[model samples]
Target: MDEAGLSRRGLLGLAIGAGAAGLAVGAGAGTAAGVAVGRAREREDAESAYAFFGAHQAGITTPVQDHLHFAAFDMMARTTRDDLVSLLQDWSYAASRMTQGLEVSATGAVDGSPEAPPDDTGEALGLPASGLTITFGFGPTLFETVEGEDRYAIAALRPRALERLPAFLGDDLDPAASGGDLCIQVCADDPQVAVHAIRNLSRIAFGRARIRWSQLGFGRTSRTTAAQSTPRNLFGYKDGTANILANDAASLDEHVWVAASDEPAWLAGGTYLVARKVAMLIETWDRVRLSEQDAIIGRSKGEGAPLSGGTEYTEPDFATTDANGAPAIDPNSHVRLAHPEHNGGIRILRRGYNYVDGNNELGRLAAGLFFLSFQRTPESFIRLQRSLSTDLMAEYIRHVGSGVWAIPPGARDGSFVGAGLFA
Candidate 1:
């Protein structure tokens, strides 16, 4: 433990306890030599990697990695169940090896016969595992389409919670990017490591499936555990200062993990993943006055404290009024509307990332938060988003891309991913 009576990993959480907590800049590790040594140990640890076999997938509760490569794919027309199963089996084998920093195949890279193409892409050949985790999910369409066609003959297996997301206010969804038959979320501390995982997985998918769309992101916007510091969004405010921590077993069981009782037993220990590509109007926001910006977010830009309160973590005095009789924390502020107190004590585990994908036609930076959240049911996200419809931050952002997928329970050592679906 540190001098503060908190473990080295608890610094960020301590800040949250302080209220008005967001992120602590430069909080962990010390000195160049110390950082170097720490990183070396981390590299060794990363090489061993998180086990791909578990009761639940790793990335959902794992500490949010620094980089992300999220992809959604659609099975090719006429793709058979056998073809899909084969693809899943191959992917499972490859993922198990790659997570341990091994090449995807024994004939990996240059080891494959010269007469044949290399098995692994080889970009990550010399890299450590870098804490890479790849999680896969199935979309509603994967079970049955909106037209009521059971394309995959697995419609009966679909969870009642896996239906299509209802159109929400201010959604400018792009159909090409909004839905997918399958989704893969690859996250890692190393950008190359994350990308490499997706690249090879796409290769394995080959004829069975094709990429519908993908998003690249960096700088995680939330911490999944007390071990991590809260990160900032492109808006420069601390994002998810009071987010659900991985160590909060009670919260995980209640809000994030799917129970056998939730139905469709194949997803018992799994969860639902909702992805939203929220494009922030950065230029407009930058031009706004600082005080106005703080008002919009309901937190001080500098301290991240509730406008109504003492510290960032201070329970917002929602009933407090100003001298003129206006509510202290604006009723429309992002934080006020999204807070669990106002939303029936509902909360979602956020694991979003900041992204910049060049400039738009008007030359404004095409950047925003790639909002990702895992919950026991899609209703959780829907409820939160519906409450945010009146949020002050809404005008400054647009939801352009979106998806919802039912992540299956993790595969055991001898089984392939999603093997239960087939069974």
Candidate 2:
């Protein structure tokens, strides 16, 4: 049958049949059993060109400032769906074994890319990002199972975020229309480490499945700058000055948490949104003076606080009038343009990382953010960027990369990638 015409139900049926046969080997048993099977497969089908053994060990590491971010996706032949599912089941089992005993935070979801009635279970899977650093992986149901000869996609994100988890996991954001199947982020002190992590993950992913496409990202600096350090956008003087903060649990309940009234029972424990952008341009940015730069950004150079006068994270009254009764914060200022609320209100949960690259021909360094955000909707995030693109900072920064992903509800055992897509 044509790959596109094959349905997920058909693929699942195939996987169930194959899974029963592989039971003599117990392919779907558990992580421990899965690892043993995975090792056997690696040895039997071992191709020297694809070093599956070494690739497996490259998945874990201690906290480092610079770490690699890698992603890969593939299409499965209808006939091979069962074998593929068995293979992935084993791979996940083996991988978890290798990284055993480490404080790893993970979430798995099926493809619920298309909208469905909310699952009404009150049980909450309190996967909070407070104080604990963690990375997330997203596997669509179709991709997870050995199904039809259909194209299945998987997206994994590393680098855990305590402050940014709400936005990254929130459901209001849609990623299918945005063109990305997987997303991964990690924090490494060194750039090389980040690249190494990404490359290794790609190897494992490609080694097991067929990879259609991939990409990587690096950050400009390891630390957040003093001036542009709002919770959402960077400091370019007035950047993200008008952001909202879930100051109290009540507010957090209102903005960050998904309403129990709107989602599925399984989805009850989930937050959904995946906001991502690829920002570039720094060479031209460095030449501007501190004073001029501050004026353009609408804040002091040393601190990211508002230009209307206040400390970092403090509120700025945008409505205040100047001597001539004009606006105290210039309407065109970066912050003013991005957020005019002035109380340091209107916040977003930012979970982003940086990337770097070199052009051998030009002999120059290319770097910027692998920007990701999770908000309730596209409206607030869109408004902020729209302000930036038309304002003064636009002259220095250009959005070279962009995508949006929908982070669906997590999954139970045996059900593979994006079960939610059809759920």
Candidate 3:
């Protein structure tokens, strides 16, 4: 948060230019130097190598990228506290370089001696960063495993709000795709870039940790900035039409970021992340009547306007009724149930994506919404989810995988993410 609006952790969408003096990149961080040079290579690219050109935006609120590769990891059994710390340090260093459009290290991919293995995976060699952002999170299991083993000895430092999400009404959660000790969310415009990030980071994790479960997503279902239009979900309805925009500082502070006055002093400025893998019954939903579909969601299929009347951005007038005097929006409609007006003014910043994992044995597309949301406290999500238990739309979807994590604040130059927990 410097005067030029460049904070290493905050500006994932924009690389700081050559004039950023006193940058604390480590030895051989030609990575940072290369980023500055790469942007200046062309005047037009220099103008907009990443989103927003030169704005002070954090990764969570950065304009939503087109693809996502999210992976959750479990620390290896018997690994000590030092192993965890070193793993994070290595990850932070690698993430910092990769986001700047460089390889995992200064002598990465192919620059090394032929006698040795290259430092990078090499698939993304010719690609730009693609506006990449790698965000890390620590799950409740990271603090203490199910067997009560506190391998990292940092369990005491875990935030009170960082716990597993309670099972919702329609949850059919699969253990294989559920919990993790740590998670990394990689987003970029190119699907390969997103895949490359997870591949390289997983290679870096080698033995200290391993991916417990992973998901690949495309066609983002939400937008984080006003410049971007709302996207549609697999249900063919506009999603995230009322998302918390990056410019909404008031809502961000009140509903997304953790405050200094909150408990677990180490996590100030950080936020809570909730991820749910919602599987849709596409065939069943398609067979339903069109008007019935609109009624279930409480929004117009095309314009995404509230059924109660007005455009996408217009606030719904839930009290409005039809010619017969029935409620314009069904009490069981999704929009009404999840709206802040119904949930004590609660809202979560969504950064979800539509996912299709090929076809299943029955020939139905194995697809769903990989839902990701950030909130100041887990309760914001919990309350809204509780209210959605009666949603009519719930009949066509199932929650199959779920997790919650404590997102640490942005790291400073020369510091690894979550450095405060160790302190």
Query: Which has the greatest lDDT?
Result: 1
Q: Each prediction's TM-score against the native? A: 0.90, 0.54, 0.88
Cα lDDT computed for each candidate against the true fold: 0.86, 0.40, 0.85
lDDT, candidate 2, equals: 0.40
Q: Which digits, one per residue and each the tens of the lDDT, describe model 2 over residues 71-161?
A: 4344344425344455444443423322231111132222233364222111111111111111323333333432322343221211121
TM-score head-to-head 1 vs 2, winner = 1
lDDT, residue 56, model 2: 12
**Candidate 1, 1-423: lDDT as tens digits:** 122221123433443443332223343323333435445555554554888888888898898888999999999888888988998889888998888888999989999899989999898877778788999999999898777877767889998999889989989999987889999999987788889999999999999999999999999999988878768899989889878888899998999999878788889899999999999999999999998899899888887788887876677888988788998889999988999998888889999999999999999999999999999999999999999989999989999999999999999988988889889
Top-down TM-score ranking: 1, 3, 2
Pairs of residues clashing in candidate 3:
none
Q: What's the distance in Å from true for residue 138, model 1?
A: 0.2
Writing each residue's lDDT as its tens digit, candidate 3 over 10-118 gives: 2333444332432554543544664554444333221223421112224588889888999999999889989999998999888888887789998899999889989
- Which runs of model 3 end up more than 4 angstroms from their true locations? 1-58
